[model samples]
Target: AQTIHQWPVAEIKAVGSPLSLGCTIKGKSSPNLYWYWQATGGTLQQLFYSITVGQVESVVQLNLSASRPKDDQFILSTEKLLLSHSGFYLCAWSPGQYQDTQYFGPGTRLLVL
Candidate 1:
């Protein structure tokens, strides 16, 4: 069984400040990530698709960066937080297959003021 963990269930931050969000997987190694976000009262968007450590693909240019430093860890961060960055951030994992059913972590919410 795999367990996904996300840090800081929610946040309230100022614009232009730096932000970092993290996710970790337990009982599973080398899982791929499909990160996503949803704006307030808006639709969901896929942000990053990562196959392995140091192998991340961007689905949108949201001025965010993600890294998988370890097989079980994924990090998303930005040097500056924009108002547009305020949203619901979700981290999901799969067994490195497009058709695999991805398991989602408990997500983080950000409110950029």
Candidate 2:
């Protein structure tokens, strides 16, 4: 069975603070990763995705960045947090293609002040 892990279950931060979130997948080899964000009471948005280590693609300009340093590791970070950044961050993995169902991690919740 595959398992996905996300760090810092939740966070509360002030504007301009540095922020970092991470996700790791186990029991899967070279799975694809996708990041998503949802604002308070807002719809979900796809932020970016990674198909391989060191290769990331952006879907929107959220002023945040993502990196996949290891085959099983994905990271999301920003130098300065904005109040608009407050929301839920999700990390999802698909077997080998986008058409496959994505399995999501526990997710990180951020409340930027």
Candidate 3:
């Protein structure tokens, strides 16, 4: 059984401050990972994705960045979050070597102040 975890379920941050959010997967190996964001009442947008280690692709560039330091950990962050950066972020994963369904974990909802 595979499970995903995200931290800071909700946050309120100042516009010029730094931000960090985390996601981790358990019970899955070499999974395909993705980061997605949804603005207030807006549709979800793909931010980044990794098919394997050291290989990440950007689907959309919202002036944000992501990194995968481990097989099961992906991080999304920004040095300065703009007012437009406020949104709900979700981490998702698919089984390795298979085009299986992608599953989203509990997401982090952020509001910029």
Candidate 4:
């Protein structure tokens, strides 16, 4: 069985500051990783996804970038922040099969100012 974990940001941050978030998957090698975001009272959207290490694809037009730095770890970051970026971030994974359902792990909430 695979285990996924997301690291949550536990504080508020100002605009223009750098942001970094990460997630890890255990017991599963080379799993399909995904990043999703949802604003307060807004719809959820997929931001990025990766099928292999060192190859990440952007699914949505967000001002953020995601990378699969390790076989079991994924990272999301941005050079600068914006107020509109405030919301919730979720990390998910799937078995990479087209018919496989994606499973959500954990999420982080951001209350930007």
Candidate 2 vs candidate 3, lDDT winner: 2
| lDDT score, candidate 3 | 0.91
Candidates in order, TM-scores: namely: 0.93, 0.95, 0.94, 0.92
Model 3 superposed RMSD (Cα)? 1.1
TM-score result, candidate 2: 0.95
Give me the candidate number with maximum lDDT: 2
Clashing pairs in 2: none
Model 4 C-alpha lDDT per residue in residues 59-112, reported as the tens digit of each score: 987789998989888998899889988889989888886735788876888766
Candidates arranged by TM-score, highest first? 2, 3, 1, 4
lDDT of each: 0.89, 0.94, 0.91, 0.85
| lDDT (10s digit) by residue, model 1, range 5-101 | 9988999999999999999999877788878998877877989988888888989999999888888888999999999999999999988755588
Poorest lDDT segment (10 consecutive residues) of candidate 4? 97-106
Model 3, range 23-83, lDDT digits (tens) per residue? 9999998999999999878888889999887678899888788889999999898999899
Q: Name model 3 segments beyond 4 Å from true.
A: none
Off by over 4 Å in 4: none
Q: Lowest-lDDT window of 10 residues in candidate 3?
A: 94-103
TM accuracy, model 4: 0.92
Clashes in each model (backbone N, CA, C under 3 Å)?
0, 0, 0, 0
**Model 3: colliding residue pairs:** none
Give residue 8's error in model 1 in angstroms.
1.1
Model 1 Cα shift for residue 39 (angstroms) = 1.7
